[model samples]
Target chain A: MGELRLMKGNEALAEAAVRAGSDGYFGYPITPQSEVIEYLMAEKPFERTGMVVLQAESEVAAINMLYGGGGTGKKVMTSSSSPGISLMQEGLSYMAGAEIPCIVANIVRGGPGLGDIQPAQSDYFQSVKGGGHGDYRLPVLAPASVQEMSDFVPISYDLAFKYRTPVLIVSDGLIGQMMEKVELFDQMPRITDKEINEKYPWATNGKPKGKERRILTSLDLDPHKLEKHNFHLQDKYKQIEANEVRYELIDCDDAEYIIVAYGSSSRISQKAIQLARAEGIKVGILRLITLWPFPKKPIDELVIKGIKGFLAVEMSAGQMVEDVKLTVRERTKVEHFGRYGGVIHSPEEVLEALKTKIIGG
Target chain B: MSEIAIQDIIKPENLVYEKTKLMTDKTLSYCPGCGHGTTHRLIMEVIEELGQENETIGVAPVGCSVLAYEFMNVDMQEAAHGRAPAVATAIKRLWPKKVVFTYQGDGDLAAIGTAETIHACNRGEQIVIVFINNGIYGMTGGQMAPTTLPGMKTATSPYGRDIATMGNPLKITELVAQLPGTYYVTRHSVHTAAAARKAKRAIKKAFQNQLDGKPGLSFVEVVSNCNSGWKMEPVQSNIWMEENMFPYYELGDIKVDGKLLSK
Candidate 1:
């Protein structure tokens, strides 16, 4: 419960993990997200709390380290941006299939190649829709502000343990590079390994007392056995979809215009909402938190309320709009707004779109 | 031999069944003459002998060993391409009392995972590493590995890896041993019975160091040949490893604090 202090999003996450009594942190330093590593190094969380702060040889090594830590039922985390995150998808997929718990943070940037290191939420599909090979989904947390980045660090830790699956803190260079005030929570009074151990007895953490050894893996090569595993994976995804849809709704209850956005775009949507309100035009905004589950229920609710039509704002070319359309299902006119390659959309641009659409409506 | 002594020692076949079976089964995907099978057996033998089958945690790297978790008869974690060291660091930190090690290939360990491997060695995290140097990529078809010999050809470098362009092979074992944090570093091959026996001992030593709660990095790089990828017979591949590979990557325990803790 420390007083509010100005801090960078990446640094705040590093501090939050330290406060949560994490035992290990493994990561390769990448742009924008490098602050997370730098902060851990400066704080020497390893020396202070027996937290293992290791600068990995590459992003590949850092994520694999997270897999090791999670296998042992330890709290582990790693951070990277676009290109680095792409390398981690393999390990992340394995974690999901094996049901290992860990936190992976991606401060995304423009991509498709060696995209610039500026702010871009281009990794939206890579993070939420299973960036890696195989059929899997990471419970993605999209944080729009610097404060959410700090708060989500601990929350991701909790979610990983709760779900026994990898949790992603999907932000952008904008959030990681921006500075803002945040209230850092003191270490929770109650923290123990026994709780997770007792709950997740299946954890290969160690040989369970006298029980048989547990294996942390997702391979089921046998046609029948592999089908069972795939079935189980699909069932888990269904559970997640049923239980974990999250979003922010603004003024959509009585509005004719609905704007859909997330991460940085969501930040712009908030401004658009303000502008629309000031102009006496009714504009409701829906910002997604759980990007993978897609927050479809909220959109369905919006459609039910007859909240005008929908406008999807994203850094990439209309990727998430697919899910938005599926949710609305032609019940409303769903328009698409996207910026591809490296360019990012501005709040002004969103406002201008609103002027052309919502205000005009 | 005394009856007590004989009874105390467990056999290799009995090492992996029953409880530790959870981590491994009959399924396999490695090619014939692949030393990965033998290495996997050796690790299982060590775990069973030390009664660490339960407490031991193995981190599998990308490559042929990516599915190592599916075969190792213990609690296993799959790491990204070369990031076994990083994953091992996290597991060790979270569960300090448990034993942790990473099984990696030349490409995964020497190339893609070099960052995690180097830093883990630098910090001296008390973890063991099993480095497999087969000289070529097995999963993505035959490709030049970081340890690929000069004049070796792969799909990427079809005209044999020219030192002028691709550079000479890297001796990762010696490179890692140079770090202060590395306590036990060795280079061994499974080319012959004698070499295989020696390689087993080296792998056991690496595992033992982690168990002794020693503070350092222990690594063993096995110089193995890829018969299918090399397009050579199994026996010829072994000879190739002995003649061409050994001259470059020498074998022996580089560092062992036997008196300090052994291994």
Candidate 2:
């Protein structure tokens, strides 16, 4: 029981960043996520926790700032919406290649290009798949509630530093704008410069007295060396997949049908599950906490237990359904349901979708 | 002539010059006679001379100097094409006490990275920006760059640059000097011994300003020649640059202590 407060998802995240002992935050304002930087600016985290907050010229500059700060073995973060995150792809790729540790929170909006400033879980492909060019995958954490939004900040930093890789927290307008009770974590002191040198010897802070100079760059012009680096990155992704898969199974023990979802969709499906059970349908919800490591093992276990079908609910046209299908592999039928283009689906709509698309279909 | 002993010539008192220890033993990837090597040496020398060798972090930009991290050797990070300034901005802001600088070329500093460069300078980021203006994109086989002079020929401008179609060459040093955030802005050349000395002095001053906790960004632009990119001999390229490039780009201080110098 740390301090409790009613805070918007974006505000909670900003407060959590300060409490997480973040050294710096560089971000550009975007709809549904602008509150993040606005809150940080108004709160004056620099005075309270020595966290440096800057409003960058653009999302492009913001992500590069993360690269620079994170390369120095500092815990830094940034938040943006869809279009802004798209502008950040190149920097993110470079950071991924260079193995810099940082965190990015994408408060998703409807988009192919400037779609709308409403809730949408449409970036599934971009988040799980490599949004940026090159062969790299960022660890994607999908926070379904405002509480998870606040809690995921420290978890993201921990995973980022542990793997020496970028981590992403994907939420949306619903969670970002909605106010909810959040139990805030206690403030952790920012790591001292000496501690950073000791912990991250490879960081590009400065050359220690007699130590070898450090160089952090993604460019290895030699084909063999680049290939070797790629192999090393792949090995890291494999380890993350093996150990970091996270999900929550609700009322899944006696489920005949399961609704697979994450983020806001998972929250909606929880309500839909309750409705379906009231109507004598044995449906359960599978809420993914980590979108990247996809939680295939749990899905496999459900399939082995004779679950008939899966309905992948989302706020997109149908993205995560692909992953669910790939994991189910025709052993069971998997279908997709959603109201896209910034439309929010109701619990009744989800229940109808499950009955029509999976149970009855 | 008397035979000189190797030991005598290499003696401590007899040695007039030696490579700065700040630079690593790694071989530079720059082409023969490229000004990048000279500029790299000058920056490292300044850092070493200031006793800030272990207290500095450098952001290396893309282009011929993308491999600058391999040679200069202090803790360094390689930035994307034109984002060195943005990268350097975060480093300096996070660790205000640490000496931070960005090494960028014309294409990186003036063209693709113009927004980052301008905004960083405008925001008065407390860092040094070492801009290398070589007129053409040397790393990508002589492509037309933002700083490419009118009528100059490059791989992309095989028939000579058409000013109306290609746009006028950007005088970025002059452009940045107009910004209030810049504490010191200067333009120099490194083609001759005297020019190299002046350029070295400018670099040292820029680094010293950051160490002194100056209020704004320090910019040092070094107009250099790319002989291989220009498809000319090293000597011919230097001579051509003096005749054609110097009159347009000019030389000497453009701004000092946040005040623009009058023509």
Quick one: best DockQ, which candidate?
2
Restricted to chain B, the TM-score per model reads 0.88, 0.98
Q: Which stretches of candidate 2 lie over 4 Å from their true place?
A: none
Displacement of residue A79 (Cα, Å) in model 1 is 2.4
Worst 10 residues of 2 chain A by lDDT: A352-361
| Model 1 regions more than 4 Å off | A1-3, A189-193, A315-317, A337-349, A358-361, B1-41, B48-51, B62-71, B111-115, B134-167, B190-197, B213-215, B224-245, B256-263
lDDT of 1 by residue, A1-361 (tens): 5758798988888888888777778888889789998999999986777787877777776777777777777788889999999988888887888888889999988877888888787787788789888888889999888788878878788778877899999898888888899988877522457875777777667666667667676666578998888888889888888988788887777788888988888887788778778878788888888898788888887888877788898888888888899899999878778777657777777878766654454
Instruction: Please provide, for model 1 over B95-180, each residue's C-alpha lDDT reduced to its tens digit, 9 standing for 90 to 100.
Output: 77888888999999999877778888888989989888989998888889988889987888899999998888888777777788
* lDDT values, one for every candidate: 0.81, 0.94
Q: Write the per-residue lDDT of candidate 2 for residues B1-263, one digit (tens) a residue.
A: 99988877787887799999988898888877778899999999999999998899999999999889989979999999999999999999999999999999999999999999999999999999999998999999999999999999999999999999999999999999999999999998888889999999999999999999888999999999999999998999999999999999999898898888889
What is the TM-score of model 1 when looking only at chain B?
Answer: 0.88
Q: Estimate each model's TM-score.
A: 0.84, 0.99
RMSD of 2: 0.8
